[model samples]
Every structure is written in C-alpha cells, then in structure tokens.
Target: MKSVKGHLRNRLVKARKKSAGQANIWLFYSFKLDADVPIIGDLEMLYWVSELETQPQVRRFTMEHEVEISLEELGDSFEEITVTRVEHIDGSIEFHQVASKQHDSFEKVSVPVRYKIENRIEKSHLVVIPAARLKAFSKSSLSFWLKVIAFVSQVRGYDLRYEMGQVGTSISICGDGTIETLLESLSITDPALAVGAVCRSVLQGNIIVDGLRSFGRNTRWRTP
Candidate 1:
C-alpha cells in the first residue's frame, strides 16, 4: 500500500528478539493504524471486542491511545491486552476490557484509568464487570434478549439477507425505537421467530446498542 507521500503505507512494528513480524493494524472497527481504543491501545482484547462488534455492536468508542501503560508492577511476565473507552450520547464515558482467562495477568493493568471528558480532567474511573454481576444483568432481561440470543445461537445465521427492509421500518415507528417495542410492532406470527429476526438484524449490523450497560426491554436501539 502506497500513497502520494510514499510512506511505508501503514505498519505497526511488533519488535522481536530474533526477527520482527510486520503486520497491518486492523483492529476491525477502528481501521486507522496506531489508533487508540479508549485506554487500551490496539492489543488482544481489542481484537476480541472486534469479533463481538459483528453482532450486536456498540458504537460509543472515542479515540484510542498510541500506548497507555498501567502503573501496577508485575515481576516480568507481561501479557499484552487492550482497554476500551466508550463515549455515550449522554456524556458518560465508560472503560471496559475483555474477560481474560489469565486472571492474575489481567489484574490492575489499567487500574484507575484517569481520563478527560468535555475538556475537564475527570477522576480516575475504571469498570470491569465481574462474571456474576454481568450474568445477573442478563438474567433480569432474560425474557426477551435471552430468547433472541438463544435462538440465534441454536440456529445458523443468514448466509444471504434478501430483504429485511420491514425490520428497519418497524423499528423506526416503534416508540423510542426500543427492541421490545419493535418486537411488538413486528406482529410476527411466531414470537420466537421475531426474536430471531431481531438477533439477525443485530448481526447484520442493522441494529446496535450499548451491550456494556444493563440492557433489557427498555434498552434503546438504533439503525446504522
């Protein structure tokens, strides 16, 4: 890849002891090389979130960093991870990262990530939902979204989306455009199938919401 400037196109140097590997920084949604992901620069956790972005995406990302380090001291074994920053429409900024199998390694890496918002240096705030608390959020909203997620999980997604224009139209008319309202308006004969359609709509990137928040019937949705 070349430009009129004749730069090395776009490259993220991964230094190695013997020989370095040259690869492109395609952290998926944030396509720009060297782009920051909230607090976590492009790393493994960012890639995990990228995978989830395909279905039920969250679009609250702000600019990422070149590199943001944690002050916590680890003896030597360091693992690369990413922390994500999301900016909501309500002027709230949230920091989150992927759940890691290496629990010890993940501890205190991005501890107290102090960030700025609206030109003010806010206090250090970090959020990583424990598995139980996160699951509890889902359990409360289990009536609808659980059904949708379950249906989507049990069946293969659409290989070819012919025409779902009505899904969008129905959402547009629903009050506040919430998924629950959308389902009600859809009037699909089989309610489970309607839930399946909602899941598909989300997977197709037609519907997006902040999955980090405690979401349920009242969760707001939008078209992209």
Candidate 2:
C-alpha cells in the first residue's frame, strides 16, 4: 500500500476528477489547532472524533499516526492509528506510548505506535483511544465503546442523524437537563436510544453535552 501522506495527497490532487464518494472531503474542527483540519477516515472514526469535540472534559485531539510504514515488514494491514488524546485532565497536551487494543477502543494506558520509513522502524507516542479517568483500560469497556462507536458511527448513522435533526430542535427548545431527563420529557423511553440521539445531535453541532466522562443517561447536556 502507498504511504498515508502520499495516498491522501494523490487523492487530493485528483480530487476534482474523482467521482462522488472518492472525492468527498471531511473538514473537522480541532480545538488543539484552533482551526478546521481535513479529516480522512471511515465514518466510525469521523463520528468518534466529532463526539469527542462536544464533550466538556475533552480538551483537544491530535493525530496519533500519519506516516509511512513498510508493507514488507508489517504486512498489508497494520494498525492505522489516527488522532488520539490522553484522557487525563492536565490542561496540557501530551501523547504517549499506549497499549495496543486488546479488544478495540481506547480509554487509557496508552501504547506506542510503530511504523517503518525506508525500512527503518520508528516509534510514535500516539495514545490509542483513552477514556477519561486513568485506569488499566478494560477489555470489556473497550469492546462496548468500540461496538457503540462503530454502530452509531457506521451501521445506524444515517437513520440516527435524520432523527437527530428533528430531535435537536426539540432539545434546543426543551431546555437543559441530563440526557435521560431531557429525552424523558420528549417521551424517548430507551436510555440507550436517547443517548444515541443526543450524541448524534452533538456530532451535528446542533446540541451540546455538558460532559464526556462516562457518557450515559445521567450525562448533563444543553443546546448551543
């Protein structure tokens, strides 16, 4: 496979010529850069990053890996870690060696990303997905979040976003409350379903969540 930079650059150069989905560019706002960054990834990653930006606890995000790797050494498919941020509330930006996902999904306890350039291996301090509050990064937690992120970001994304468009207007008018309470007022009974809707709104930049820590029914939220 071609290098990440090379592939993206080539795609960008011929962007206008490429048909439909091939040329679709995603612009994501980065708190760290204080500007919109061009995002390239699948819908799951796009949704994950978007959700992170809305949470109060999240300070910023940084790409973990965007470098060349040796296909001969690492094979056709290696871990292509993108943006990652430490979970600690330091008010300081830092990325470090994080453990590889035993299950998939990052919450804490980071591991290093290894890549090859010109047949030389290099290490990058890109934290994998990290949840707030330092811990060993549970397998179960990772699996759950990974499943949720994957599903909401990919599988049911379209339907959810369409629903969120309507839900967001109601949420903005409904006033402030935890995700649970607000959805309850709207007669949305399922907490999981409610969280997904609110989260979709958050991604759409219509509504806002008060916190990113342990996002659930009790998570505080508001409209912007």
Whole-model lDDT per candidate = 0.44, 0.45
Which window of ten consecutive residues has the lowest lDDT sum in model 1?
Answer: 4-13
- Poorest 10 consecutive residues of model 2 by lDDT? 11-20
**Which pairs in model 1 have colliding backbones?**
36-64, 36-65, 37-64, 40-83
TM-scores for every candidate against the unseen true structure:
0.36, 0.35
Model 1 over residues 3-52: C-alpha lDDT tens digits? 41122111112223221145324323221111333322223323324332
Write candidate 2's Cα lDDT for 52-111 as tens digits: 543445555554433432223345544432334434345643343222224343344333
Q: How many residue-pair clashes does candidate 2 contain? A: 13
Error of 1 at 160 (Å): 9.6
